[model samples]
Target: MSHKPTTVAELGEFTVLIDVRSPAEFALDHIPGAINCPVLDDEERRVVGTTYVQVSAFEARKIGGAMVARNIARHLDEQFRDKPRDWRPLVYCWRGGMRSGSFVNWLRLVGWDAQQLKGGYKAWRAHVIEQIAQRAPALDLRVLCGPTGSAKTRVLQALAAQGEQVLDLEDLAAHRGSVLGAVPGRPQPSQKAFETQLAHRLAALDPARRVWVEAESRRIGRITVPEPLLQRLRESPVVEIAAPPDARLAYLLRDYAWLGDDRPALADKLDGLRELLPRDVLAQWREWALAGALAPLFEALMARHYDPLYARSQGRHLAGLPNAHRVASDDLSDAGIQSLAGHIASLP
Candidate 1:
């Protein structure tokens, strides 16, 4: 008998996972580590769908089948040629319908252990959503609250190194959770992809142990935190890290100095602040950016813009913050951050 379709729980048993959806569909969201091996290119999938609606299902199937066969053959020749006979691959399409079924059937015919994902990508997506909802509420979350440049993220890393559970949400979102938080040359993941990544991390965590996370606004760059997880974060016990203005300014200069290299990009980002700051202040900041005087510019931004904004936002949103365990450091050096992490980890 031929192998049957497998459940999502069995995903780990397979050595290779293939997603046979069109490029556009796969780009929107996919299972982590699954390779795209589309049975239909984006244009061809569109053409087949149009033909099915306007012309005839029979005609569409005929054209689509031929295209799928050619594409699969090409994939086998170029991508899968060296696969060992014992290789086990799991395949899925949009709904585990024709696309993945056809691919699995062919792979099995060639004497490979191939299985289809029972409900395909849609099933996996539903699983992700369900897992996040179920697991987030059960986490022993500890929110790390601080003003900008307090080195909260660095502290989270230090905690992780010390074997404490930490969820770096900003890293998952590919952003630093600020107006200028974007990492150069690294675009943020799609919102769906971000959630999938978050869900995976949440699943790996031990719910009974405390999980450290940085405090963030609802949105990070283009991605929004899922409500279930965000709710837990908001209500968690808080650890507030405080530092002197000079210490924070120095840290900001070291951490974000790369922004000074691209004066045009830095100036463009500064434009977003015009409505909030005085016109003269905004112009001066821009002038400093263009002139590459980053240290003074950073100091001014910390004192004037970020510090005041952080105070207001913390008071308004983080009601639990007032009762937080406070850790004050005048130095944000590696030793200081690690020491802070040690103190946080020792918290009950």
Candidate 2:
């Protein structure tokens, strides 16, 4: 029946992590495996907030307390009804304030070993950032280098499937790290959420082992890779996937077939590169996109944009890229990618 707050480092598999923030707050970011059981839902929180600001403090507490009590009761009945007496759940709120403390108090009264998270979600976020800063420098990160359309992600997936340790940043970021990198329909998570997920993933791996990751700049879409981790990635040795231009083009055409179905969206994405390319050049790309000339457009982008960008970036930033151990292949098919992965995995 102790009410001590548990530190983030003290987290274990046996204890459940419950987030008692509003649904909107939880949506922005929470602990990696936390379940949302908000003490005050979105509207209730807003109403209580407005009351606190405009009405008397006593009035807001009276209103919020009643709402919190009712919500806590609902959760106890619907969510925690079947829990065993010994079940330990770590509960948190925005800043480990009254909301989570109230819920933890209720659960403790129920004779369960429920504890409040020390400093709540904010503390957890700080811990994640610190962990990355401390951990990234010591890891043996192996970068998989390739230009755009090189299918580095797919090959990295193959390498992962072959039982290699991989850190798939693009998958975590929900982006391909390009102007047109957004996955259709699936939106990216907030930057905090992305970093939390990355830190959690990194925590699970043995940093002593060689961790395979795709080469990327510090930024991916709207999300930026944590600077400490990005520094390690930039400094890592590279294993280049030297696929021919034709193979890369063919692979991109198949992989990005959806872009062909939505020409308007494709054209808009092209417009993002306006500052880099001339207006006339962009106009031609727009024309190519609208006419569904996606293949030629893909080639034009690779030749005029992605390839040159990769060349400069690698030469300037990637210390291990020039002497990268090359795995040359003319095949960009799934099986071919698998073969490339196997070869890379077998490297000393």
Candidate 3:
């Protein structure tokens, strides 16, 4: 109990982070690298909360205390039985109050250094927001701009391979940032979790070197870019990769070919364009998708749907993009991308 509270700065490779919050809470978001060893499981937490509000705090504690003790004992027997004496760990709950404090006391009695996060997950969330706000504005960010299917993400991967700092927001969010952006089986993280992931990546980047990121709208799938980072990105210098319509379409066929495998899924996603295009145009695209005519349909989409949206978004949000230095390619092939990446790496 005498162990002082801890901050993120003091955590090390060996420091174990235990999130004592309920599993449901942890799923929405928790500190990165933290493990869930809840003192109260989801249903038990609900029952205890109902008791506190409807019955009384005393009765709730009387009921919850037993559950907490049993769960703690189980953890002690299973998760902590092999721990050495010098093991120091950080434990946190939503507010660093009852849940984490109770767990800390038990660990202290067992002779391990168990420090509570000063203000728990709430504090950690505040830290993420603050760090992004404070550091984002100062970033030497270079936005890689191109219309859809221009292989911007590929270029970014190449840049990273060449040891340049790169941030792939789509990769962090686990989505491609479009109507058809969802990966076939993988789902995007909760907004909070996505932000937490983004914050962690941002923290690791050095501000001195140019950090490259793809140009994206504020919303990527369901993940909203942090405001500070988005603002800085919008204002940063742009480097557009200009691929021909045929090259982009060829690239789209390769990239989005999976959509043709599930006609229903493709049909459903194409339905998202209903408001944007004429019914006849939408019908033709839907027909093409259902009929497995991917190349023609993808071409139509770029010409009618994606290209126009990209143009407007670039003009409205990325003010400097009209004069952005262009990197043209007749091909978006592996070699072409590598060449483009090499040219970009030489930029001042």
Candidate 4:
């Protein structure tokens, strides 16, 4: 008699899907490639949850179960409608509990190759921790460290386009690594979610080949770097990119043009500097913002704060870490980053 592949580990590499849930829930943490197809949206889930607590279990189950069934049916009819007949999709709810079990059973009945993740997202998270904490240190690392607006992300993008090995921490984290780093029109995931995504992305890369990454502090907005990878970053060599003031300013404007008319966000991000600056300096900062003198505001902010902070941080970190070759952005053409990348790759 033939047996079906029941366990997630037994499935090997397969498409993963997280059952429908809120963006916040998914952002807080989720399995990699597990697109959220919640059995109930936020409002519906909240309603069901309230019923479960305030009303009788029988009543809650009746209402919640029907809602979940409706959601699953909608998911099949709309989202999974165009999926190929042979497509294998793994579905899981929070803990491979009742919600996911019901969906899985329904999928099987409908003749789709559907299976529930044994322990659901929790199991996948444990897998991520084990893989990153235990397995990542074994790989060769190339850290790309630079001040804000140094075009590190662009460099990484160029490298990938040229078939070089690269891992985008910022891309995976959905942050730009600064007070103003949040992408316009896009919301970043929670820090925990970022680490989960990072582990999954890192796991897929060639560990023997050097992986290129931008240098980031312990925290990027709400997310902190994972301990294992953070340790690796601390030990890795730094590739400092130098640029002129004008170049840097141009890069900043170019990078953040999406903020177009959102002067308030700009003001709010800069306003956080009040505590950092002296009274007079703070007044001057406010004046610049009020006067629409963005260039001067940015320049002063970078010089007085960011540059000094980075210098000190690098100085401290450099005491224990070796320096890799430095690349001047002005000196390097569009191809210069690649040349620099090649040189870094050649290092022992």
Best by TM-score: 3
- Model 1 C-alpha lDDT per residue in residues 1-348, reported as the tens digit of each score: 468879899999999899999999999899999999999999999999999999999999999999999999999889988999999999999999999999998888888999999999989989999999999999998899999999999999999999999999999988998878998787999988999999999989998889998888899998999998888888888999989988888888888989988998898898988889999999999999899899888888888888898999877777689899998899898888888889888888
Model 2, CA-based lDDT = 0.90
Residues 181-299 of candidate 2: C-alpha lDDT, one tens digit per residue:
99987789999999899888888889779999998888899999999988898888989888889999999998998999989889999989999999999999999999999999999
Candidate 4 lDDT over residue span 87-168, tens digit each:
6777776777787788877777777777777777777777777878975677576777666657788878876776767878
Superior candidate under TM-score, 1 versus 3: 3
lDDT of 3 by residue, 120-139 (tens): 99999998888888888988
C-alpha TM-score for every candidate: 0.94, 0.96, 0.97, 0.83
| Alpha-carbon local distance difference test for all models | 0.91, 0.90, 0.90, 0.72
Tell me the lDDT of model 3 at 110: 93
In candidate 3, which residue ranges exceed 4 Å CA deviation? none
Candidate 4 RMSD computed on C-alpha atoms after optimal superposition onto the true structure: 3.4
lDDT of 3 at 51: 100
Candidate 4 lDDT at 296 equals: 80
Where does candidate 1 clash, by residue pair?
A: none
